[model samples]
Target: MRTLDSLILDQISGGADAGSLTTADTILVCDDPTGDLTAAACGSGRRVVVLDSDYSRCQRAISLGAQIAGDRRLDEFLAGSNGSAVAVGEMPKSLSRLDYLARSIAGAGFDTVTCVFGANNKHLARSMNETLATSFEEVSASRGRGKFRCLVATGPRNVTYEPAAGDGLVAVGGVFSGARADHGGELLRSALPAQLGRFLDLGCGNGSVSRGLDGDITATDSDADAVLSARAIGLSTTWDDAGSRFPAGTFDTIALNPPFHAGTTVDATLVSSLLDASARLLAPGGCLYLVHNSHLRYRPEVERRLGSVEQVARNQRYTVLRATAR
Candidate 1:
């Protein structure tokens, strides 16, 4: 088992008491993108309600035999809920978003919140623990094991958030690059065809590319927060992981900067999924424009999914590819 998984199993197996989940407990699991923990905890006793701003993660949680509470809405689920909140995966890198998550968990009336995070994200751990400490009456932590940690906080909930404007989107976090455009996004934008017709921004983060262009464009991302941010910037956005809402052959071009990590772990499946989705969405002779780290070998995947691939641009760190649909 993975180190984090083993540690979590140990915690859960030890018992569901002393700030841990107990029989028939209503528990909120946060940031569980993979739904592994939700599935494990769904066996008995606890009623697992998973919350994630990422729409795909929410769907995955539901597929694991856990019912969708609040229609898989993270913000709505966090408000005035009656469950003990627990986070068993990575934390957002954005401090403001982390603060919002912690404050929300505290305010949800959870008497016990247990979080297990990779020790590598010390800043995230420190911030969350501090937030819990300030919001609750008691907080304690386990010694870091193989760069993993479990923190248990219990007591009366005393959390409050000053309602902010714009939902303080950037402040609310979970979007890629945390409110700013990423370098790959900028490179992909610079390489866009001068004139465009129907196109897509697959895996769009804040819809940066589509927001800058004027044309028949659709932006799709798995993250609801990203879709919200994209719409706020006047870009047409859809919250879907695989662009399922759009019919096939619906676009002339697709631009992407697919994320390749699950937390700190580098996983290339996300890149492959984006390439396949772009291939399925493009009309014959349509083009796919994408950017990725120079080290990742996506050329083979592009050739397999789309058609002949051409290097459009390359920097010291990023390589942009143009693949035409056969």
Candidate 2:
């Protein structure tokens, strides 16, 4: 929780200490990427569960000693709860989660739900308000501090998720930046080796790389939304942190369009992790088809992992590289 997050506890959750837990209480904390506030809300006698899209975030929840489902969605997790649930959540930045959260709360048989939010994201604020209007009979808000706000709602109403369009891509409530084209991804897909056999789509989003590709294509992503979207398209999908889900030397080739950001901060190290993972996952003589911003200087680093990294294709914004595992 940042200072704004602290405001959430102070204003919405009564400083995170007002509730008395019972064995019968089922508490859900949603989108708990950091796990700090969610862990604090997990009292002694109640069952608490967390929902997070990111594998690292879910791992953080486990490390903080909170239980979460393998599916990590609210509806999926709450279906198993024996009693009615109460929930506290951070505001979602996208319409996907907001829509899903509303439907899930209704499906979960929740008695009450509150979301702590900052108005910095107008789209999120609007979606949250819309979801609340449809999902709850009574909804109220707390006074704001700086850009922060809170909404308390009860009673359930029906909600339908966003519709499919264009490529029939339906992002599963957790895809970052939505299920759209990534120039790097498109470039990498175009530049894939024609001799492909068993392959992995690392950081797969909506199976964009594996779609229409021949052979045994396995797709993996850290985002639950991306895996769900990939699976929706009939791809064999796995939730992964980098390429750790598979054994060493598992694939004949890998397609990587490495992410450079975690949250909003740009971090160049993500490409290194992807390259290392690609190396570990590729058999000898296997190939890595990688794409990134043209100025990223990934060649030197990529060469360190797989030998003879060659320049494949380059445009004004992107550069594609091919690496052969030694």
Give the candidate number with the greatest TM-score.
Answer: 2
lDDT of 1 by residue, 1-326 (tens): 46665565565445555644443256556555456666676754577776566666777777776765422334546676664555554455555555555666667765566554433435445667776577566666756667676665556466765422242223124566655677888899999997767989998876666666877878888776677667666777788876888898999989988998876678978787778789889999999998999899999989988779999999989999999999
**What are the Cα lDDT values of the candidates?**
0.69, 0.71
> Each candidate's root-mean-square deviation in Å?
4.0, 3.2
* lDDT for predicted candidate 2 compared with the true structure: 0.71
Off by over 4 Å in 2: 15-24, 63-65, 80-84, 117-127, 137-141, 145-147, 160-166, 177-179
TM-score (all chains, Cα) for each model:
0.79, 0.85
Candidate 2 per-residue lDDT over residues 127-208, each given as its tens digit: 5776677766766676766666677666666444443334655566757545666677788888887878889999887777
**How much is the lDDT of residue 54 in candidate 1?**
68
Provide the clashing-pair count of each candidate structure: 0, 0
